[model samples]
Target: MQTTTLTSTWPQTLCDPSGRRQAKPRNKGCTMVIDKGIGQHAFADMLSTSGEYIDIVKFGFGTSTLYPLPVIQSKIALAIKHGITVIPGGTLLEAAVRLDLIPGFFRQVLELGFTGIEVSDGTINLSRTLRNDLIRDAKSMGLTVYTEYGKKLFGSRIDVTDFARTAEQDWACGAELVTVEARESGKGVGLFDEHGECREGDLSHILRVVPNLDRLMWEAPLKEQQVSLIKSLGPDVHLGNIPVNDIITLETMRRGLRSDTFELQQVPYSEYMI
Candidate 1:
């Protein structure tokens, strides 16, 4: 399926406060929304309102399997129509791996109109070889592949060395983005501390090792986390696991429309005259 390119509604002549955010089909500044459950109407409304700002919509965890086959197909089809890559959560792949039903899972996902795949082992143990193979296999199927790093357990911190190595290898195996896992809660996992605050040192370390920061997608579900990461990593950083309702607000922040990031925007000469 061909992905459509969407242009921003804001006038091109005006300067954006947070500098210029990239348009749709962008490699950087990508946003992946985590959809737990929303009816077809709400889904369509979301896309119609701010589809240009979204890059992907992930059916969180195993929720995709809970929906009716037709509903799943419709959602995936709609997302693809709007140029958003839709995929079941990586947990589903983990389940398939555990059950030895990888092939069936792949068949079912493609048949359901999913255009992307997320390969993650947050809860399950996955070997490096298996991870590489899964990434390659998905890419060979003409699906966009996103691989995630880090475990889901609370207090599970990121190991800079292992993350660097794994991210490098996943990219080598043809995955498009290496996601940093923060779970849906965005607390006590990966780069976040128990209070949902960022471990700034660890975040810096990761950036230092991964020079191509565009290849990383940080899972920032909370507003604070999102704001902090955007400030720390710049507005162009790719972020995932955003709530469905926050698409417009997040986009605003990226453009420096929100108070938290308003200072990032530049002032016009007329404003200085006042």
Candidate 2:
């Protein structure tokens, strides 16, 4: 999808240090919303209001199964209309892997209008061979494959070196991006501590080691985590697991319209000219 052009109350090129783009840079940064079964009507409303800022909309966890077929279809259709990529959450894919339903999962995903797939081993163990195979299968079927690099286990901290390696492998396997899991809670998992604080040192280490930060999605559901990541990585870092309602807030932060990230933007030079 092109970098969105938003019609706003304020001028487009006003205070933004880096001007808004004709196409939003996904590698530079994007926002992925984790939806836990929002009704199609509500989903449509959200898209209408803030779809420009949303790059990906995930039917979170296994809740996609809980919705009626038409509802799921409607939501996917809504997202596609706004140029947003839609996919079922990694956990659902993990469940399919657990039940030996991989074939059916892919067919159904395409049938239901999902344009992408997430291959993850959060709750299940997938061998290296199986992981690569899944990526190849998804790609062969013309699906965008997004692999995740961390477990959903409670005490699972990132093994920085392992993550760096897996990210490279996933990209080579045709995955679009590697998501670092923080689950819904965003506590005690990946780079987050139990108190929902980011492990700054770990994040710094990964930033230095990982060849490309643009190919990663950080699942940060908390406001503090959002602020910290923006501070450390700049406003355009890809953030995932965002609540359905917080879409605007995140967008504001990215645009430097929010105080949390206002400092990230510099004053426009035109102001001084006057």
Candidate 3:
């Protein structure tokens, strides 16, 4: 009897249809996963299978706190082993800010091996001064800082002018990346309508304001939103708040392995045959 074994380099004929997906240690096209209490074994399995495609893992909302310290530590270690930057969700930080636990919060995350932290005021009104201070503080603690723009509200919208201004300010304050909020639903939020559709005009306005897409991550948790983004911005656009189960599916779309974006990145497979 004969059996087949697969290796990372096993297939040479197949390539990304778009031919534009960035490799690890990449500066752009980042995928941030929103982990909402996945167990240790499942997380390890996830890392084994899909960590390469994930750049950042955010323990969704305040769920990380719900886990035992040892469990959280183990998860962080697994992520670090896979070369993925992990962070507690921004809401966790907001809660910490309100409790005046910012310093200890930074200390605890650092001790737990989180390589990054997100500064966001999605649920609370975070003042600009405090926001800047938090970014600087996180940087001082030697943590990678990702700031978020826009608020999380039912009918909230992005004022393009405000977004442009705040994005620049975030960069100036040492934010490595600024994620646009779409909440977990990705509807009636920044750049999206109640129907969960992309507001192309607002998106266009944002594109005009930003110098490049490399530093901006759009939180698009829905399949339609993902399809729209990859189609509009190509496969290199950074996306966040991705559900854990959908990582590979989203990657397929980015690579044009899915029909929705197959044409966007279509390439001749024979071109790679040798």
lDDT of 2 by residue, 189-270 (tens): 9999999999989998999999878789899999999989988887878899899999988877877778887776667568
Q: What is the lDDT of residue 215 in candidate 2?
A: 84
Name the TM-score of candidate 3. Answer: 0.93
Collision pairs in model 1:
17-265
lDDT of 3: 0.89
Please give the lDDT score at residue 222 for candidate 3.
97
lDDT tens readout by residue for model 3, 80-199: 888899999999999999999987898888888899999999999999999999999889888999999888988899988888888899999899999999999898988899999999
Candidates in order have lDDT scores of: 0.91, 0.87, 0.89
- Across 74-97, the per-residue lDDT of candidate 1 in tens digits comes to 888989888999999999999999
Q: Rank order by TM-score, top first?
A: 1, 3, 2
Better of 1 and 2 by lDDT: 1
Please give the lDDT score for candidate 1: 0.91
How far off is residue 189 in model 1, in Å? 0.5
